[model samples]
Target: MPLSHNPNLLQPRVPILNWIADMGSDISDEIRYRLCATLASSTLPALLGSLNSFCITLLAYARLQNTILLYIALCDLIFGVMRVCATNVSWLRTVAADLVVVSGIGWATMMAATMVVVGFSDDTPMLIIVVASGLGSCAGIIARNYAAPRLALAQVIVIDASFKIPFCIHHPEFIPLILLQGAGFIGVAIWIMRQQRETTVRAIAGQIESRTQSLQDPLTGLLNRRGFAEKAQSMRQTSSTKALLYLDLDGFKQVNDRFGHGVGDEILRQAARRLSICLPNASICRMGGDEFIVLADCHSRQEAAVIGARIIQTISLPTVTSAGQASVGVSIGISLFDPMEVDLERAMVEADEALYRAKRAGRGCALLHDPAMSGASKAMA
Candidate 1:
């Protein structure tokens, strides 16, 4: 199948609903989902960010009798509550939202504390404590959220600036030294983030590629049986009608035996191409060997008949490949299905049985499954 027809790529995914997506349009949904899953599943990072900030802010509020510190402490408590609720409700989806909001609250706590120390000019122990905490938060963002590079970089910049701005303002003589050290810190953070993001993206992409391969028929580039089942699982509709066509290429063995397997493989690929053209909106599958299956929306037996006959005509021509030349006829059995009465398995089996009838009647036609047809024919006999 062409890459354009591959459904697995660029499909819209609900951010895992309760545990799904977290990235923006800049990032792919698959990457977003995996990162969300990783962040949500881990409790230590979020727990540390919330508890550490809350306890420190609450402590400063109680000791200084500062009303601003109390509000910051409450904001920290709210972030902690959000993290806890996300973890308890879903093990994978809320951290990205929590990270943004919590990072802001943390910066406010640090900045307010720094402003208080600067105003007093007392050079109390609180200034040292505030600076230490701000540095820790910046480091934590870089280390814990590296996979989400943009968020980490933005948070680090804001949180680091909160307390740094106060120090830069107070002592003009120390500006040069502080700027040099800050540049070095940023450079190292960028280097670390780049390395980690590359590794994480590669890992997630490999897993997705592996999964797509498993559900695929590598030879014809069509969905395999399992792949068909997976797609059908998503299409179950009680109110809608669908037709399942079980198809087999007649004289395939003769071509394989005479011209060799190379020509046979080319013939199969050509047949798949023709099916794709005939049923542009249908789910087509190569069920191993020369057998293939298709499921398409069908409103009536007449529609099923038309589809089955069209599939036969579309692939009726002799195929000429670089390997060799061969001609093969097709046999198709169609079964109409609706999710209300029966499931996919039963529909598949009915289609197979119809194909059996088509082959028995002579191998170049289409047949719709009708149990009563067999009984009526027996009565005539």
Candidate 2:
């Protein structure tokens, strides 16, 4: 029953315990420090699971000198505890990314070393276990850092090299076979990194396209009502002198009823274009149907009136389409913002009231909101 006579035990002439020690010493201090930092940012659950399993396996087998096994377990435990504490510190969080990556490399190196040391007499079993575990670690790195290909690549290189180099040095006769396997793994890693890059880019592009569609109108290519409000809110916070002009297209409903909605859409597009030309600095938005809003910076009430008049004139111009010539006028109501009284909602209501007054005074005119005009219109009604 003695395993001392086993042929497989005699085959491994090279001792791996000394090789592991030499490999650890060969790593530069700077590289070791970086690896330690990376390990600190790695996911706590994954690290804990892998480290605990390896420690338990070593204990079960009663591997050479329980002292070495205990040292390895203690190192992993200290690293995990440091990482958990780092998450709560502001400065530590800044370097957490580097910590996670370095820590992963370090832990992987330790696992590879352990495999070689414990399975020195069983080369075939060691090869299988080491390759499988290396690939699994690579997959985990991909899952965690797929958005960052460079980081994932670095981790993969460290992991695969740790196993491959030591194995090649020990069994030079199997160099060709080992090189071929390493090349295959490198190919797989490259493919995974490329896929991750493409996926990240596509996701970012999709999000941008979705946001653009939400903020823009399909027909006129102007900002929609929601977009205008968002922009105006930010502008209002910064600027003290501002004006709001509410415009309603006159006889637009009749055009839709007579010529069809297709032609009506063309008219709206043309009107938006003309409004943009008239007020180049203004933020213009189509507030659904035939209503539009313009936010502009103005020095005085006179400047607001002038801008409104220009908009009305441009919109009144004949719109030539495939369905012949069509003319639609615009009624504008102006409201000015005062730094002392910053009430956007009240200004909007006043502008709406003035728009009605412009329509009542015969279409295609601009009227500034006045308190006296509102009371007069109410009394007359």
**In every candidate, how many clashes are there?**
3, 13
The positional error of residue 39 in candidate 1, measured at the CA in angstroms, is: 5.6
lDDT tens digits, residue span 243-340, model 1? 98899999999889888888889999999999998899999999999999998999988788788778888898878877656789998888887866
| TM-score of every prediction relative to native | 0.79, 0.61
lDDT of 2 by residue, 1-381 (tens): 112112121112234312221213433444333333333334565556466536543652463453665666565566655445444445555444444444544565566555545445354654566567667777786665544455566666766776667667778898899779878877887787667556655565566678778989889988997788788777755756878888999999999899999999999999989888888888899999999988888888778877887787789999997799999998888777763466767777877877898889887888887666552222111
Ten residues in sequence with the least summed lDDT for candidate 1: 3-12
What shift in Å separates residue 306 of candidate 1 from its native position after superposition?
A: 2.1
Best by lDDT: 1
- Taken over the whole model, the C-alpha lDDT of each candidate is 0.70, 0.66
Error of 2 at 92 (Å): 11
- Index of the highest-TM-score prediction: 1
Worst 10 residues of 2 by lDDT: 1-10
